[model samples]
Structures are given as C-alpha cells and as structure tokens.
Target: MTDLESADRLTEARVALAEAMALHEQGDLVAAERRYRAALAQDYRPADVLPLLAGLLGRLSRPEDALHAWDQLLAIEPDHAVALHEKGLTLHWLDRTEEAIASLERACALDPDNATALGNLGVVLADAHRNLEALRTFRRALALQPDNLHLRHQVRRLGSGAVPFWHIPMMNDAPRNDAFEAAIKAAIGVAGPEARVLDIGAGSGLLSLMAARAGARKVVACEMEPMIAEMAQQIVAQNGYAARITVHAKPSTELAVGAELDAPADILVSEILSSDLLTEKVLDTFEDAHRRLLAPDALVIPRAASAMGCLVASENLAGYAFVGDVSGFDLSAFTAFAPQRLPIHGTMTGWQRLSGDVELVRLDLTQKKHDATLARLSVPVTASGRAIGIVQWMHIDLWDGVTFDNHPDGYHDGGWLQVLHSFPEPIDVVAGEVLDIAAGHDRITLILWPLPRAAD
Candidate 1:
C-alpha cells in the first residue's frame, strides 16, 4: 500500500481509540467496549486498549470476556502488572481460586510496591483458608503503606482469625500468669540458671519470657501457629531476651533434641490446657514432649491438672443446654444435637450448686503415658433442683503449691471460663439423692453423661 493509504488507516485507528476513551469517560461502557475492540482489531496500540476493554467488560459483569481480554494483553506483554492483577481478580470472581492466587502472586512479585495488588492477593489466600500466608502478605502491604488503616485492620483481622479469640484475655489473666510465673521461677531456680527450658505452645513468648526473667539462661519455645510464633520471636527480641530465648514455629511433636533444642529440656514449661482441660491436645503434646523433647527428670510446670465441677441448676444456663418447645412446635428432639459443653464466664453466669464441687478427672502431666478412662461417679445431691449438668472448671497443680482454678464461686475475668458439661437431658434430683454420672476423658475432651438412675 502507498504511504497515503497507510496513513489513512492509522488515522482511522487513532480516531476509534480516541472515541473509545471518550465513551469510557462518559460511562457508555457498551459503546466504549465496541470502540476499544475495534481499535484492537485495527492493531492500534493493543497493549493500552486491551486493559481498558477488559476493565470495561469486568464493570459490565462479563468476567469471561474480561479474562479473554486480559489473556490477549498478557500475550503481548507477559509481565504486565496491571493485567496480571486484574486477571487474578477476574479469576477469583470465577471461583478459580488457585489460578487467581498464582496470578495475584505474580503481580505482587512484579510490582513489589503495589499495596492494592498485595491486598488482593491476601484476600484470595484468605479465601483459600491459607490464613498464615494471607497474614504474611497483608503484613508486607502494611509495611509499604504503614498508615493505611484498611491494611492495618486486615493484618489484625487475619492475625486474630488465625488464632483463638481467648488469647488476649488469657494474656490479661494476672492470676493465671502469676501462677505460671511462680511455677516457672521455682522450676528454673531448682534446675539452675543454665538449665535448658522448653515451652510448648509458647503463646506471645510469655512463659518463656517469664523463665528468662527468672534467670533461665536457655529457653526454647515452640508455638504451632506461625503468626503467633513470629510475634513471639519479635517479643523476645523486644524484651532483650532474644539471646536467652529461641522460639520455634512448630508443634512439640516436631521438636528434636539437637535441632530446636540443644538437649532434652531440663525444665518443661507448657500451658496448653483448654477451658475443659484437654481439648487443646495437651495430653498428646505432653506425651510427645516426654517421649522426645524432655529430660527424664525434667521439672514439669503444672505437674498435674484436674477437671473439677459441681452438680448445678441454672435457669439461665438451661436455655443454652436444652431445647424443647419453640414457637408452638415440639423441638425437644433438636436438643439431642446441643453442645455437649458450654463455656461460661464463671462469676457472670447465674447458677446454683446442687452439689459441692467434685473432681471429675485428674491427669498427672508428669506421667509419661495417658490412657482414656471412663468410670462411674456418684454425685450426692445437696440441693433440691433440676440438675442440668456439671459446671466444670480446672484446677492446675503447678510447681509446689502454685495452683490455679477458675471456680464459679470466686474466679472472674480469667482466661479460663467454666464449662457446663450438659447432660443428654436435665435430671431431676432430691437433696439426699445420689445422681450417677459417667465422667472421664477420651484423651482430647471431657466426657460427662448422666447414667440411668437405678430403681429408686
């Protein structure tokens, strides 16, 4: 073709591109997309035109079309950050999570300073239940835009979402902390300043710090949650205990004698007991530590833990434990699926003792082995009322006389809440009657059930 003919074609393409921009500015998405596509067909600056077209299609809720446009742009400029970011978003909208994460990750890598891309990547990772990765990504974005409240909120949200909600309150429990510290200090004092101290589930490195403050020269802490573990390391450094403490982001089962620890720990300090006692796999963790991570004569903090509670009647708690008639319908059968145990703030929840507090089960943490056991418990009723279940709490036997219990009577605002071990159904009892109960531990949880009363 002659120069004049080529020039005319180029002029027509430029006009189409200009019209597309004008239409896009005016919110004429359909018209804008047509002109944009027309410019691309004429081979007029396809790189710039494709992104505009794709974004417009996405606005029109045409993800498939938008994906195709993004693909076309990527083919021209494979490392285009904007194209990759938008494509990742489109893929996420299409429910292709893995692909979306890959694209968003590439975009973030290519444009390291793009906080929006990093935030979007975090969102995709979170949706995939990869919370640790999501948290790390948000942290990176927050570092880049330190004052961004959204990024800060995302960081806190993901960090908290990855761990339990009780951690903060648990940290604030001064009595619990004091008990553990006393035990740790006593254990360290007995083991000597150079003793190797190991803390399993070292939340916020609090106990390890306590051990360090108590003159423990060497402390190895393990926390399974990576985010918490990272923070623990930071806290250790912040408190100038980094030289004395090393935090590993691993479960106790994964720790080795010479790897995470120089030798079997001379003092084992772990606080993994759940509200009901063993739901946090304290038995498995302690057993594993005994088998692989501790010295044969290691001083174990909280040498024993007991599940304790009393037979109780509570009109307020019964609502949480049972279901019967609801809005003119017999919904009592639904009670079969009610929560076996309900956690309640001891002093806040209204309840009256039907019987004195009884030791439901006791675990000798220093013992090397634990087997699941269920036995008969005959609870003598002291009050005439309908007993719903046992109001269970914990009594932790730390070093020497260092003990802590969240008894419903006086314990308040502690990390540990009292748990109500609801019976299958409410049992009516007399003041002098003996209520038979089957109470035990299935390794990881407390098992409390009302046995059928013998013919009275």
Candidate 2:
C-alpha cells in the first residue's frame, strides 16, 4: 500500500477506536463491540484494540468470545502482563481453572509486583484445593501490599480454615500446654542438649520451641498446613529459636532423614491425637514417622495413651443420643443415623456416672508396630439409671512421669472434651449388674458396643 493510503487507514481506525470507547462508556456495548471489531480489522494497534474488545465482550456476557479475544492479544504479545492477567480471569469465569492458574502464574512471574494477579492466582489455587500454594501466594501479595486489608483478611481466613478450630484453644489450655512442655523439657534433658528433635504436626511450633528452649541444638518441625507452618516460622524467629529450629510446611510422611532433618531424630514429639484418640490418623502418622523420620530407639513423648470412661446417664445427654416421639410422631428410626460420638464440655454438660472409670483402650506409642484390635470389657454398674452411653476422655502418659488427663470430673476449660459414645438405644440396669461391652479400635476409629445382657 502507498504511504498516503496507510495514513488514511490509520486515521479511520483511530476514529473508530474513539467511537467505541465513547459507546462503551454510554452502556451501548453492542455498538461499541462493532466499532472495536472495525478498528481491529484495520490492524490499528491490534495489541491495544484486542484488550478493549475482550473486556467489552466480557461486559456483554460473552466469556468464550472474550477469552478468544484475549488469546489473540497474547498471540501478538506473548509476555503482555495485562493480557495474561485478564485472560486468566476470563478462563476462570469459563470454569477453566488449570488454564487460569497457568495464565495468572505467568502474569505474576512477568510482573512480580502485580498484587491483583497474585491475589487472583491465590483464589484459583484455593478453589482447586491447593491451599498450601494459595496461602503462599496470598502471603506474597500481602508482602507487596502491606496495607491491603483484603489481602490481610484472606491470609487470616485461609489460615483459619486450613488448620483445625481446636488448635488455638488447645494452645491456651494451661494444663495441657504445661504437661506437654514439661514432657518436652524432660525428654530434652534426657536426650541431652545435642539431641536432634523432630516435632510432627507443629501447629504453632510450640513443641519445637519448647525443645529449643530446653537447649536442644537441632529441632525440625513439620506442619501440613501451609498457613500454620508460615506462622510457626515467624513465631520461631520471634522467640529467637529460628536458628535452632527448621520448620517444614509438609506432613511427616513427606519428610526425609537428610532433607528436613540432618539424620534420624533422637526425639520424636507429636500431638496429632483427636478427641477419640485415633480419629486423626495418629496411628498412621506415627507409624510413618517411626519407619522413616525417627531413630530406632528414638525417645517418643506421650509414650502411651488410653481412652478411659464410665457408663453415663444424663437426661440432657440422652436427648442428644436417642430421639423418639418428636411432637407425637415416632422418629426412633432417626436414632440409627445419630452421631456415634458427641463431644461435650464435661463441666457444662449435665451427666452422672453409672459406673466407675474403666480403661476402654490403650495405645503404646513407643512400639514399633501396631494393628487394629477389639476386646471385651465388663463394667460393674455402680448406680441404677438409664444408660445412654459412655462418656469417654483421654489419659496421655507423656515421658516417664509427666501425665495429662481431661478426666470428666475435674478437668475443665481444656481443648480435650469428653466424647460420648452413644448407644443405639438406652438400657436400664441395677446397681449390682455387670454391663458387658466391646471396646477397642479399628486403627482409625474408637469402637464401643454394648453386649446383650444375660437372661436371669
């Protein structure tokens, strides 16, 4: 084409672009879209025209078309940060999560300071259940924009959802914390200051910090939750124990002898137990740790744990255990679907013991191997009442002499709540009768079932 013809075409394209922007601002998206296409057809700065067209298409509720327009811009300018960022958003709108993540990640890499891109990437990652990556991305965005309240809220919100709700309460429980700390100090003392300590499930890096404060030279802690792990790192640094402690944001199963730790640790401290003692896969976690992360003779804190409880009878507790005749209708069948275990605050919940405390099951944490087991137990009734089920609590034998128990009678305001293993139906009995029950564990859950009473 001649120079005169090229200049004439450019003038026409500039006029069309101006008209498109004016129409778009006036809410006439259909007319604006036509003008944008006209400018693009003339190849009048396709890079700039494509973005405007893509954004207009999005406003027109044409996500697929908008995606294609963004792609066209990317084809021309591969590293265009705005194109990549906008394209990522369009892909996410289209439910193309993986592609969105890829585009947003590239945009972030191209413009490391783009807090918007980083925040969008974090949202996608979180939607995909890639919480660890999402948390890290959110943290990076917060670092870039320190005063961004939205970013700060995302960090805290995601962090809370990533970890269990009971963690903060557990940390605040003076009795539990004191017991664990005492056990940790004792273990460090016995293992000597040079002992290598491995703290699995480092919620707030409390155990690892305790190890450091006890003069351990090497401490390695791993938290599966990314947000918690990051906070742990900060807490360790704040406490001036960062130099002696290395926190890995991963599960104990992911740790290696030479990577997260210099060698097999001499002491293993983990508090992954659930209210029922085994629901948190404590067995699986500990087994994996023993096989890979700890020495053969590693000193394990909480060497043993036992679930103890007695037969319980409470009008208030019975209401939660079995339901029947609600508003003159028989809903006893709904009892079959009731919660097998109900967590209750011992001090607040109204209950009475029908039998003295009985050991339901015990786990030997120091053992190298374990398997699921079930055994019979007999509890002599101490009072005659309608037994709903057994209200059980934990007794952790930490170290040799340090022990902790949230016994339903005296222990209150702790993270450990007594769990009621409800029966299928209420049973009545006399004071001198023996109630035979089956109690044990299936490795992942606690088992408690009442046996049939013998005919008189």
Please tell me which predicted candidate would have the highest lDDT against the true structure.
Answer: 1
lDDT values of the candidates? 0.91, 0.91
In model 1, which residue pairs have backbone atoms overlapping below 3 Å? none
Q: Give, for candidate 1, the lowest lDDT window spanning 10 residues.
A: 343-352
- The digit string of per-residue lDDT tens for model 1 on 39-90 reads 8887999898898899999999999999999999999999999999999999
**RMSD to true structure for each model, in Å:** 1.9, 2.9
> What's model 2's overall lDDT?
0.91
Per-prediction TM-score to the true structure, in the order listed: 0.95, 0.89
- Candidate 2 lDDT over 208-316, as tens digits, reads 9888988998999998877788889999999999889999998989999877788999999999888889998899988888898889989998899999999989999
What candidate 1 gets wrong by more than 4 Å, as runs, is 1-5, 346-348
In terms of TM-score, which candidate is strongest? 1
